[model samples]
Target: MTRSVALFATCLGDQLWPEVVEATVAVLERAGCRVTFDPAQTCCAQPAFNSGYHDEAKAVARAFVEVFERADAVVAPSGSCTAMVHRYPELFRDEPDWRARAEAVAHKAFELSAFLVRELGVVDLGARLSARVAWHDACHALRELGVHDEPRRLLRAVAGLELVELRTGESCCGFGGTFAVKFPELSTAMLDHKLSGLDDRVDVLSAVDSSCLMQMRGRLQRQGSRVRAMHLAEILASR
Candidate 1:
């Protein structure tokens, strides 16, 4: 059976890390899903929502709901964005009709790892990657979405991959969307603390969210660190 999945190309994934988008499609297709992309899709308004702009966030959230409503399932490469989508009903609390629609969209939306492991019942995609990798738990994915073990389960099943534990794997990488911008020094301080936990033995650092990777990768590059940061989708799609 072929499940129709609407690939919600997250703002960062589409603009900054398109490879993650492609990798997500490849992995979903490998799982017997027919993936579709809609240009009508845009940001899930997480930035505005996080910045305390409910009206603006609601507008973007409505657009997202309308765009992905018809798909059998909507999956995003970003756990943060997926978490934002799941909160659509709260955003539309004043409008009952929109709230109902938002609830439906929320029920259908899922992060990539969760959809693969929980919905499809697939832990392994026969991916091969010869590297010592450490998985970072994106705050929204772990705390908001409760997706701590699914990604680890999937990574453990990958052939030629050695999954190592990061001392600060469960801590925030300090990329709290606008939080970094609002508090630069505090964000940098938090990120530096997280980086210290990256063991020198790690060839690659993997996380379910590209936003976290982007933040960590920038700091790694600035400091001339050799460890590379990659999204879990890219690692899982590796063949």
Candidate 2:
């Protein structure tokens, strides 16, 4: 049986890193899943939700629920956004019907790595990327979603890929959506601490969240470091 999966392209993944979405599609298709993309999809309203705009967040969450209610599974390349989708029920708590729909949608959604490993029982994708890469755990994916070992397991299965330990791999990249913008100095300080922990040995830094990759990549670029930041989907899609 071919599982039907919907691609929930987060705002960041759709705008800043379409390659991540493309890679996600590639990985899903390679896993024997039928993938669908909806043009009507927009932001998961994580920004509004995080910034204390509950009504606006609820509106967007309702749209998301309507858009992806039918897929057997909804997979996103971003962990933070997936985590946000899981909060739709909270956004629509006062309304029983909408809350039920939101809860159902949340139950169907999964981060790409989690869907592949947990749902499809797939560990190896025959991906080949020869580089000393360190995997950074996106905070929401690690703590909120409990997606610690799945990504590493998939990475380890990639042929010729060397998964190195980043000293600050578990630390936040300081890209808490609005949190970074509201407190720039603190965010930068946290980012600097993260960067300082990186040794001179890694060639690529990979994470499940594009937002984190963007935060760390900007700093690495400013410092002119050779380490490249990439999404795990892109890495896993490599053949």
Q: Estimate each model's TM-score.
A: 0.98, 0.98
What is the C-alpha lDDT profile of model 1 across 109-151, one tens digit per residue?
Answer: 9999999999999998999999999888999999989998899
Angstrom error of the Cα, residue 225, model 1: value is 0.6
RMSD of each: 0.8, 0.9
**How do the residues 141-225 of candidate 2 rate in per-residue lDDT, one tens digit apiece?**
9998999999999999999899987887688888898888899999999999887777788889999999999999998999899
Candidate 1: segments with Cα more than 4 A from true spot:
none
True-structure Cα RMSD, model 1? 0.8
Record all residue pairs in model 2 with backbone atoms less than 3 Å apart, i.e. clashing. Answer: none
Worst 10 residues of 2 by lDDT: 164-173
